[model samples]
Target: MNRRGFMKLMGSGAGLAAGSAIMGSTLVQNAMAAAPRRGGTIKLAWVDAVDTLDPHFTASLGSVKILNNIFNGLLKVAYDGKKVSFVPDLAETWEMPDDKTHVFTLRRGVKFHNGDPCDAAAVKWSLDRVKDPAVSSPHAWKFETLAGIDIVDESTIRMRFSKPYAFLPVALTGSTGRAGTIVSKRAVEQHGKAFGRNPVGTGPFKFAGWRENESITLERNPDYFEPGLPYLDGVKILLIKEPTAAVAAMMSGQVYGMSLSPFQFIPQLKANKNLKVYGEVEGNYSFVGMNNRRAPFDDPMMRKAVAAAIDRNTIVKQGYFGEAIPAYSCISPPMTGFYDKNIGNSGRGQRFDLKKAMEYRKQSKYQGEVNPVYIVAQGFTGSGGSGTRNSQLLLPMLEKIGIKPKIELLDRAVWTKRRNGGDFDMYDEAWIADLDPDETIYPEWHSGKPWNFVGYSNKEFDKLLSEAQDTLNQATRKKLYD
Candidate 1:
């Protein structure tokens, strides 16, 4: 597909990118990235570099390394053709009482890639390690309900929680969380730093080699419990930085598939008929986070006005090729288990209400322009860089609703640092697939939480979250949330 065709499928182009679009150069890079023969080789690009090798200490992208090959959880929920099924991977079977805790019968004769036997003792150790403050896992939120893990026997493991969590089974599949995945206690103590590179799991694939920022290779395990599986003999994950190149590779059939941010490459995907595109409307949501600790954003009325002024539907349709849904609350409605839909008006769509936004602005008693600054990655998929294209599309839309956004484009590294440090008027941000509302709200909206990037403090929200967590009645729990 051509560049214009790709953009049309994805919506309109903004700023300098619109006038001087280079379809040819983009196609060339795309071909180069995807070009490679397939047999035992599979070229996949990581969205970001791997952060750590150890699953317990996994604080970065390296968790992907552990996910595919090194670790095997108690159960496997495969998403095939939009349906989910529980398959045997680690745990053979499980039982739940009132949905608060899961008692799993561990699989027998499982071995870590390092040759350590995976047992109840090992499972206990692995779960405990996840809670270790030293790890400071990025997903520490997932463990909030984890009361403790009780080992019933050599082959039995029961995990009791602080309360009932409907998403428990789905949560286990998450990059974070201590579910049925059993790590070898012997391995962590033996090889701490080196273990990430050299690891073992009961999965069909085994560790082959990892060339940092280049590629990570793996080969099928001959002794894998499910023999004759992993259809491919081996796979290679290339670390390509650009999304355009990744798309090009996919179109050329250089690689089977690659993880791409939908905003940047959806159009190209729609244009390629030969290629298959698999996308899920993830429970993740992105919103304009204003630094509440900073200027006018500190004003509640201003925050409310900004929230009201945003026309989510227009942005969703134009920017995301109808692939995205406009969000009003921290959690999208699709994943709102027992939560009340009326708690907040999440139906806000893409309709500019300049008069309303200005009314709220006037109420806040803000000064001239209320020119909020927005930070985004400069690159198309944004490597650690700077540019105004992202802002160009957003600023005008915000202005149409009576908000003038002063753009502050920065390199990815600086942007990330500032965002995590809570130092901007507003920013473009999103969560990947957080299948639960607790996963969406607790860390993000709760006061004093690290992931609360906007510094939004709400005691009422916290109290509701606490109430929801302990309540056994699904209706009552959702009522508390609402």
Candidate 2:
């Protein structure tokens, strides 16, 4: 993809709206007007506690958000109004010699929290570590296109790809992708299994302490590359699971910010004169995943029936309180190019149709009961609780269509294992879009991929995706994706 295609793919109108809502907040506007002031402690509250500080191993958004403050990637994606752009972070400048080769000029004078030099070797180590089979990083799949990393000098490195991947730099963005975040090699070597607990990186803040379910603390990195950044002297992240308790804490001035706000509590928060609410439509979506590896779901008719039976509008209204948009395709709306708008609309394609659902169900050989599991992740509430609520709504709908299905709620860990291990007939699955469309589409839908827990396989779809990736022309890629 060219620069124009890259920007268009990343730019989502909903994402812009979300950013505007947050940035236009009273507090944010006031802060923007004032000169940078350093030395105040910001107490932020999160509904979930981070299991690890290591960015490579972190799969949860909660952990990734915290890791972002403590790690610096080669490049970062930033939104300017509705336009998505890539900015230099650890790597000050880069040049693409060819479609498959990217050479980056690292920024000098950068240091990891452990006092290790953030040089070309460090970047190589960090990238290679993710691909290391022994490490088994959750983000290893992001670097599958990476052929090799060669250190050209103390402050320069060359990245070779197997094919012409246009979104390599976009994939390196810190916020969404952790594969490019440079870590302290010495720190990892010394800590080994304990590295995640005592993580070190070249970020705005330094990891201080983590008290499991209580809190995680980070102090200002005095040796930070960007001068007088972070504004706050320290950051204290409080682990408050309950929405009511979190709102109470915020009301009482005990917490300055809440990371993932509950949708039901938004009206109450907006009503509070002293409080300010910031939000952005994130590039994420929740979906009902059918296990194609097993009977019933293995049949295309059964999958179609289930999809037709789901009342997305009701789920959006009741589960998300009208905060979320109903997703039609696998790709969310925030992903502009890849999203097929006609897929979920009435008359255009799949929608609530009990009659059609029953027709499709009758075509299936296995007409027995279907058991769907609802897995609840950390900080699950009104806004992010689509999985739990959507699954509940699906139960009666399935029954109405003469299909017997039982819903089981499982903890995140157990649910993840069962889903990945293919031990479920059906389940709720969600995804946050990476900087590129391939990040969202390829892994989940591609046959035999690890994240393709539903066991979905379509040779034609795979061929289209492969062609899209190999093609350099943006228009052709968009056509292929469409």
Candidate 3:
């Protein structure tokens, strides 16, 4: 419900009394009721599964959104869904006179769920802990790349960057990827390895319990700073990794919500009058990532040929729901500044050109039989259908261009091991975009910089990226990025 409407309903005793009468009614019915209900479990299923509850250690949408209730960053993007703009969260206000330095004034009267006072020292402790080399948090990359964070006072913090990085503000949204969520130092030191299971933050909800991969439950913090908010008494996240079953659970009212289902289900789900479907264009790109350290793809000409021959538009039209945009380049569309204009709109070079692809391949030095491997995980074995799709349709297309990729399917257990061990030529992969442009590209393409899975890098590309980060002027930065 909108804030104004909710306030109007809550203003009257009659509306609140009426709402109390409908506590056990259906959610949709309650939504239509004039007053907000105070208690119920919000069951949600996520597309990606969460492995750890430690806020700083992982970068997945499932874990981050769940933690949104349990942790508060120094600053956060307003929930209005406009361009990402920072607003107060733990910090009441912040200022930056130059591109390299920033100062933040913390909000007072805020306490962790465990009742520890949240002061500047707590903020500094959280920030400093993330940069520890032993910790190497998935979200720690945000703090480690900076020059340093200096604690100014019990309610203030000053940050200095080694270089002029423009994406700092956007990074402090929460504890996932670029988002940096604040943690209570006392809680961590007290709990040690058990902290992930029992986190303490100054957010709307407090940790209740976690049942491994089964479910995670949370309770509302009675001392929540925002009065009359969070509405629900608790949130329960069920780790149902299978997307199809997740959709079914939502439809049956076994769960309140879930991430998207197969593209084909959108129309059917929309037709259900009892359900509400929400959507927005996202910064996600799925592709066949080639192992640049391997034989055929190790040849840049062959890589170029594969890039040239793939019919990306056709892939979008047939393989995925018509929802997907054709992508040839690495950057996804939602990332505003980093898209290279020279690269095709889909982010790759261009549409299929068999002649050019063959020419590039013939120009390469390798003449032996070329075999590429496409690896897929086989572990979504429960309610969803088989984990693998038919690769037969792709063979004809590749045969016409004189390329063959032998398909390999591994169980989830083996796939995890093989992936980290670098066991295959190519693997189907997906990358969710960070709030800033630099976070989207740096970890993927910068050579010798870890997370560069493709093993492809260029000195010129690194120079451009370095220049883009330091250029404060937006236009100049875009030019340098280009």
Candidate 4:
């Protein structure tokens, strides 16, 4: 097919992306919405599967986004994805008394969904529970710098860091994947391992029920700390895995709002007059993380071959349809001060070259005799008249370098299980809502870290990253990262 023909096909196949866009039709139009409509149920859908509601355990981006709505942290990130800024949530007011100590005054009368007091004690317990090894919080690494929590009074608590950690406030945000989202101590201890299923929090919404593989129902917190808020009686999030099916539901008005709408549907959705679409440059990055412990990929030459074969510029223009920026560095373009414009050229990073990829493949252990590895994408199929457009972009490029792939569009839970167990080869996925440069790369690439899904470990890289995190000076940190 011609390039235009190929891009046209790919656009229709845009698959799962976390917090991609929210589209609303009749579901959002309220005549009295001007006067604050109070009783309408906002129906929304998620294209990815959600296994757990417990914020601390599941690393799934879908679950995290859902949890963000049902829970509140001491602070919150700027709602718009334009910049990184911290705003208060559960904490009514807070002050950093020193470089290492953070003092917070809790809002009185705040209560969990179960009517339990969400006080300073609860905050301390929640933070302590995350750090507790017995809890096995997957996000524990985000709080490694936490020294201890000291409850000053019934409505006040102080948190101390071991060092001058500038990322502390950002990490404590109420956004997805953040460490500061506080849960009720009573609810957690009462439910134990089942707490994930029955989540209790002090937010606008409360977990009503989950139908597993179908939908999650949330009801408004009648006694929410924020007065006259939430604006809706409840929210119902449908779990629709297929992209086109979701688009059909949205167009038919079966669902009022939808997130992770396939990029291919953007043009079509925009053409509809009744719907309003809100989009932002996602605070995330998608990638195919290889299981480096396995053969073929274990050889650096084969890995370099995989990296050099694909044209990133075309992927952004044709595959993403100009909806995304071509990212060479993990820190995306919106992060102005840290993002480097000089990194994406022939002299520095890997450039698209089929010849270079073939040459690298010839020098590898497999030497062009490697078995076709499985490239698993979550929540969508490749060629079966359904799935993500990612295959349209990646498949032919890899073929040029003689790395033919068998694409598997597995269910989200199964896909996550395989990747976490090292039972998969290459997983197509993204880590979203991340802000810090350290958080984005360190957890996923650092040696033996909780999120090092690829089992990659380089001592020098680790050292440099550590220095970057420790060095307070921005210029010095950039130099260390370089």
Candidate 5:
């Protein structure tokens, strides 16, 4: 979804299954002292509704969280108790002959749930499908630099790019690693449009059944390639949309795990000794954005005024229940090498001052009545209420500074549509599992790009981003982003 903006996510594994799904494996990892037991059904409570099943098209974290169990990617995030590194998933090994070329050796015997061979031809078809214009996949941007794909052998393929792309390696495992998570070509052609609902992938668990607004089920693949993985015989994913009901389900032991847990309930969830909270740090963030090409916000001073009006610290304390750090920049702290650690204290950060905001507003060209048209969405599971609540808190803040704002709450689908179409003045946006700064800045901030609902355009920014993507060295890339 490019920079869907940033929402403080609960945990980030090198590569995690759904928020709750990854932790469900903890019970087995804990039992590893003796020998991990296999065969059980793990019940997961997901707070968001999932409409799309195909990885390449869906941007919902709720879908990604569950789909993580049902799809396999070319690469995945792995940790060695010390640091996170890229590890093989569908690809047993890969080689980089040059910055623009990659050679991948696919693991044989891997088969999609549909009994289709997941070979080099399938991989080529899958990647090409995502890039196809007819597909209109939101993730198509991830492959924009691709020059061509050549199947060298039955098990090998060489990918040549027109330019150096630093995001490719991590793009495979991005968020749920959708772009590189190969899909079944035969199944796609057979199911056509419904393929998303009836997806076929080479994952440990195969999609079993799903009910509208009820549950999604997955059964263990009897012929799983990873050997004894998917310890649980089946997974039952219940769609509990409300935060209150989801929490109640968790406290009542109705479900074995939960994903996208609301911040307000974190304290109670952590207090229970029977439950475990997996809050690993990942590079995810939540942000509020404005349509730069639209009225009022089109003025830089007006934008600065709005920025000064909202207190980031208060948002962290009240909105996140003190479970999150106030984000000063879009690039989160966990991204280390490129993150501007001192940006908060660099005499410029998210500010809160009615007086300054008023001054900036006074200097702006818009002398007419300010229209604080707020756009919020039912996105982020347990946190679906996130945008609505933030709207209530923010509208008042704007009103105090002589601005009148109204809430226009939209369903996730409509909200995404309207926002991406550049139809709003101000809106709540978020991005998750952003492995690199380029992934965070380039797509969403660049002029006229998808996810750039803000409609911000600056030749300088676009140029810098172009150089950053090609500059191979971390130090130089950081400088460019800076």
Candidate 6:
């Protein structure tokens, strides 16, 4: 089947199943009808502990999710059941004077947890901090086009870009987007290195306490700009790295919910009448990332050979257990306008043909003893098992085409360091794309960007990406990407 058709079928089935599950749960239906309950704390479990609360320094999903509750950006991305839309957050309204300049009218009377006013200066300060060399934020690439910030007045600020950037507003929407979250300059200056542990923001939640490797707590911001909101009194986030322990916690009512549960436990969880299993096809995919900087992979023919030998069906079945769809393009399916469905139709790539794999292998120049390609996997979360299973299944396929691979399981920190540093020949990993296509495509493919660890660079690809970012016409952008 075509990539588009396959994705549609998978998404529709998953959506229907999720709908049925929700409808069948009497507790969920009754809770939806009741008035917003207040003065109650909800405990949520995560597989990893938040490394930092500073949105600029956040690199993990756990950190980003927690920071979303304690921070506010100038704009926000609101995801309904069907689609995503950008909305005003700290800024009441905004306008574009030209293609390169955006003016925002700051909401008045919004104060930080430290009582600092949220105004034009604060916005400028927050953005400048992310760009500062000393801060060394992982998200600095998001602001590469930023030229300057002009404070028109106390309640207004104009952001100027070197060129037209259509995704700038979208990028500033949430913690998952760019590093546009506003922070209190006073609080950050006072706390310095300790600011992450003592976060201060203008969101629904305020940092209450954090016990290292145990839990992080946040209380409702009584003076939140949105009045009569944040119905929950507080939230307690427990760091439970073990999947079994997390499931046990949910069963025992120790935690109200889990951010992510293992797929293997989904059946048991769904069978329990007291619990609900929610499912959605996430805008993400797993892959065995080949380091193009190294030998063999540096050649396009060898890369094609490797791609043709492996079966995506086996990977999805063995690694994800039917939870994932086969990815064709680097961009995931959910992101509209960017994903090139035609790429999957090409017969030369992502098509498992042992004959073509053998032909390409024979055409390659590196006939000498090739070292076993190292595939690194993290030891925590379901990804660990997925990576292990993927490597095991991939071994025989590669062996059939005259290649060898070794799997290495490491802790999260070590795995991240090696992956970011390009120290491995291959790595089993996943990319969680932002709401915008530019955010997903740019950093990973733009030659000099730090996240492009694979070191795959092409002048033509770079030109198309630049033009796509500068052009306002969606058709033109799609053409360039395609």
**What tens-digit string does per-residue lDDT give for candidate 3 at 169-228?**
666766533346888888899989788888888889999998877888899898887878
**Tens-place lDDT digits, model 4, residues 1-482:** 32122112212111101111111111121122236556878777677556688887776667877898788898876746444567778888989787788899988989899998989888999888888888888788878888899999989999988886766666677645456788888888899999999999888999999987688999988999787788888989888877788778888888887766666677887777767676656545555666778776777677777766767667666656655655544555444446555655524334566787788789887865455555565544221111256555788888877787777777655776787887766666665535667767678777788888777766655666666676666676555544
Q: How well is each residue in 1-482 modelled by candidate 2, as lDDT tens digits?
A: 43233223212110000010101011110112236666888887786446688888765667878888999899987776554667889999989899889899999989888887999998998899998878887678777788999999999999999998856665687646777778899999999989889999989999999887788999999999997687889999898777678778887788888776666677777778777776655655666666777765777777777766777777767766666666554445555545555654434334567787788778877676655443444435423544566666767877876666666677667777887788877766656545567776676767766577877776666666677777777677766655
- After superposition, the stretches of candidate 1 with alpha carbons farther than 4 Å from their true spots are 1-39, 47-50, 53-69, 78-89, 96-101, 161-167, 174-181, 191-199, 261-273, 333-352, 380-390, 400-403
TM-score each candidate.
Answer: 0.78, 0.88, 0.84, 0.85, 0.88, 0.88
Candidate-wise lDDT, in order: 0.57, 0.69, 0.63, 0.68, 0.70, 0.71
Provide the RMSD of all predictions against the true structure, rounded to 1 decimal.
Answer: 8.8, 5.6, 12.0, 7.1, 6.1, 6.2
For lDDT, candidate 3 versus 5, the one ahead is 5
Q: Which lDDT tens digits does candidate 1 get at residues 220-289?
A: 7766776556666787877666656666677777776665543556566656667555555544445566
Clash totals for all candidate models: 17, 2, 5, 1, 9, 0
**lDDT winner between candidates 1 and 5:** 5
Q: How far is candidate 6 from the true structure (C-alpha RMSD, Å)?
A: 6.2
Residue 208 C-alpha lDDT in model 2: 94
Is 2 or 4 the stronger prediction by lDDT? 2
lDDT of 4 at 225: 79
True-structure lDDT of candidate 1: 0.57
User: On residues 52-109, what C-alpha lDDT tens digit does candidate 5 reach at each position?
Assistant: 8989887666788777888887888775654446777889898999989999899998
Model 3 lDDT on a 0 to 1 scale = 0.63
